[model samples]
Target chain A: MVKPMTKTKFLERLGAELGIPPATLREEAPLNSFKAWDSMGHMSVLAMIDAELGCEVPPGALQKCKTVGDLVALVGSKLES
Target chain B: MITQIASHLPRTVLANEGLAQLYPDWTAEKIFEKTGIRERHVVDEGECASDLAFAAAERLFAGRAREADYLLFCTQTPDYLLPTTACVLQHRLGLPTTCAALDFNLGCSGYIYGLSLANSLLQSGAANRVVLLTADTYSRLIHPQDKSTRTIFGDAGTATLLSKESGSRLHSFVLGSDGSGAEQLMVKTNGARFPRADGLPTTTDESGNVHDPACLYMNGPEIFNFTLKAVPKLVREVLEKAKLSLDQIDLVVFHQANAFMLEHLRRKLGIAPEKFVLHLEHCGNTVSSTIPLALEGVITTGRLKPGMKVLLAGFGVGYSWGGCILEW
Candidate 1:
């Protein structure tokens, strides 16, 4: 079974992917608030979630994901189940 | 066996800085950082994919077009719907009357599809020599204000020459398509099913990408999801059929969809970075030509040497996927 991922670790990894430090990544911050979170960044995050986490982020979640916490929850739940 | 590979990129370039200037929201460096593309070559207003393909073939031929016995052209952007572009190329390239030519429709998975077609003809002795050309101008199909596709695709053409020695260096191939994902990445209008409507409505999604029936539309996330599932399976099956292992591959060249996607896929597959080739930094995603372009890029640097075992995987557009092991 895949180990359950925590919100802290998710933030760290996502921060690294976007080249930002984990400490600065506010969980409730809007993804659009960051300059790095553009279309290309969006795809990179999806790729990272799959390649690293071994979890397929549902494509439709791209529309629903507005905050960093939402993405963390979506991916975290995928790994737990 | 495969003998020669050559490519042509148009003179006009759509650099990232120019695109950022047009969009205003995206900066040049941000565009380059994530996509790993600084610029992409685009065709002139009147130029076409066939022209690019012809130029590539001429580079390969060097006035020796008469040596070809078979021609295969792959494209979604054909020069015309009536006369096959391959027929036009056969004539323009001065191939002999005995040469047989035809066109096949595919996008990202095109080069190896052409390779498979060429392999059969060479193995069957139907032709002693073959000219495989892949060309596409996705720039022609993009709506002016569409930022997503505008930043990603470029126009290009590639020519790969293969001879009767296909039994040796050219190894096993695995090709598959799932039409269920067909609408995910396609051009819907101007075909018999959806004829072009003069006043057809165009819509824009949350991404600020405009959608018009006459233009090319790509659901990027869905395509990526499909690729993640299909490509690894393709690699497994191809290696199994070829009776080889991942460690045995000397080089790996996949379709250069983008730097970010390719890099992640390479890491996921555990292929070393140096072994996996990326050539789209200068050309962007040239659809069908991405494979051959990567191959050609390595050939120039002498990184792709003779007698090396190379793995090629192409997945996208038609939800079509293909993989093969070549003993170079």
Candidate 2:
């Protein structure tokens, strides 16, 4: 039985992966608006998702990512694969 | 009233091989004269932080003096991101897993923080024996060609066995941090995905790119300003915390960054030049291991008689400084 990944778990994982305090991240949060989502932060997201999702997020996929909603969509498609 | 300390240092020495090649005109002797450094030990290539850490740990536990129940490892270069070096060390040392093991990712003020943590743990009856290790392979992070940092840092590690004050132990410590000026001294890459994020070649200074390793950067004047302002105050505070006056202390083991800074600090603190244990002439700044290594090298020949008061202080990198007094 496979458990479905939800926005709540994904965001929680994202927060932990980036070493950010949970409350600092929001569903409506624009990633670039915060200093925490810089190059390192983005890489941490990519690594964390790869480890948990069992696949690479694809080149340039991260640069395309701007908001939490964008990240969710990207992650959701990877889940389908 | 700083706590007692026991320490172990690496047996090998690694001279700054990169400096000579980068600055062809400068000689090692000249570098030594300027920085108060002769040579520093670097772990062989492919060696991880734990390997160097284990060497020190083995010496610390070799005598089996007293049962150590707590393990605290202070290092900036850890072996793994997931399992803290404390746990791995605990497993390797065969200490009971139930005992608390923690990793403090601190560099210069590591020993002070380690002592403070041990004191708190002991005062609370959490544990009587604690093992604190400080190790840094700055050479691993340093750009081979960046003369600014290359000449100043060296690779080395130290392990201290802290126990309850049976006949002798630690006294007290004073510590401080300023986050605003953290960037003044740091390894600006290879952390939290900065350079490692994409595997695309990251932009680097001409000298730094030659080796492809993350280079330690410093704003020399800013760090100097930070140290000049903080070190003396912190020393006074630690002495006060220990309830001792400057005259009552015997020896001072400061972070051996360089001769100029140490001399300036000695002058500022009004401590007689003889009160300082001089090891920088032989071993460059060993980062976190400086104070402990100095203690080991000095105790053998420097006449650190029992029950004499000594002060240990460390400053740099983190824009952090810490000091403590211990009765040998």
Candidate 3:
């Protein structure tokens, strides 16, 4: 069975994996709009989280994530479901 | 015709010093035992992707720079947090500022994507001479302690010149992306924060924390399953798209990921082992450069003759896979 990734953990993990500093990545923040989080960078982030954290963010979850906050909420929702 | 197009690599190198320092006793053989890497290069401490990109592009476009009108750089590692490295490279290479320049963040499949993009531009008359550069300084993203990715990756950069030709250029390309398996290979931590979340945890893997930047993690078995399942299918598709059969290809330049994976892939594809070149022994798993390096090797060795058809493919990291057939 796979464990759920907490909202906080997910963001932290996403940040670390993508090499974006925590100062820039905020909740409800659009990932691609950020300096570090581009399309491929986002993919790398998601790939790392799914593999290392054992949590999978579904397709389009990225679109739902308007802010870093929104991203975490989405992750949390996914975890709960 | 797609004759001997230009390509080149950088001279002053970084050479994976961090990874080397981390594992004093680890050699390419032992590291590759688990992951599929024999060795890799690293950028010099201060050097970024653009340096290598510019170097390779300069060499590949030398005496031909003024001829190119577009530059495409595919890499997971770039110099800045903002401007695309392609723009910097274009300026540095003295390319026309009006030229089309962009950076693509991709891993193993990068080279093929670059080629595909260049082909489209050329076919559309968007450009006459296209410089495609693929480079990754895995040293930049890899965590020293994370055994999963550290072993499999090595920093490398390669460049290829795509020109508008009459007969043969990029024959056909097949590309696919599956988001479901995206997590099988990743580097996590240091991105954004949920409202309640603190900054990234600096804990070691021993702490049982999920996100750690100190390493690259991958479900080896899962990736293996994905590769075995998708690669052969894609290769066949690309071959079919090219209107050629496997037996017709003079050389197969699959990504130089590892000896073991390549061995397994070849066996699964039923490809004669001899049709491909094995340069991973020294160059390690150079991700994007794998195919070009292989092409360079076969060309330098005189194994690939003019007019020979070549099948090139790259897959890894993003669950990304792509391949193309080209006539030399």
TM-scores, chain B, all models: 0.97, 0.89, 0.86
Better candidate number, 2 or 3, judged by TM-score: 2
For every prediction, compared with the true complex, DockQ reads: 0.43, 0.01, 0.02
* Per-prediction CA RMSD (Å): 2.8, 17.3, 12.6
Minimum summed lDDT over a 10-residue window in model 2 chain B is located at B204-213
User: What tier of docking accuracy does candidate 1 attain?
Assistant: acceptable
Supply candidate 1's per-residue lDDT for B306.
77
| lDDT per residue (tens digit) for residues A1-81 in model 1 | 234566677788799867788999998888877766755667778877786678876646765789988887777665433
Per-residue lDDT of model 3, residues A27-72, tens digit only: 7566556654533344455545445444545545554455677666
TM-score of the second chain of model 1 compared to its true counterpart: 0.97
Q: After superposition, how far is residue B273 of candidate 1 from its true place, in Å?
A: 1.0
Off by over 4 Å in 1: A1-3, A11-38, A58-81, B63-65, B165-168, B198-200
Put down candidate 2 lDDT per residue, A1-81, tens digits, no spaces.
124566677778887865556677776777766555643355456545644664445435666777877888887865533
TM-score of chain A of each: 0.81, 0.74, 0.61
Cα miss at B299, model 3 (Å)? 1.6
lDDT (tens digit, per residue) of candidate 3 on B1-328: 2333334443433234444566664554455553445455666678776777666666676665355688788876777756888888887888887788888878888888888888888888888878788877776676556554555666666777777764666868899898787777765543342332246465542212133543455655456556766788899999889889899988888887767667767865768977876777656677787787778778778998778888989998888989999787
Location of the lowest summed lDDT over 10 successive residues in candidate 1 chain B: B163-172
Report how far off residue B251 is in candidate 1 (Å): 0.5
Instruction: Write the candidate numbers in order of decreasing lDDT.
Output: 1, 2, 3
TM-score of 3: 0.71
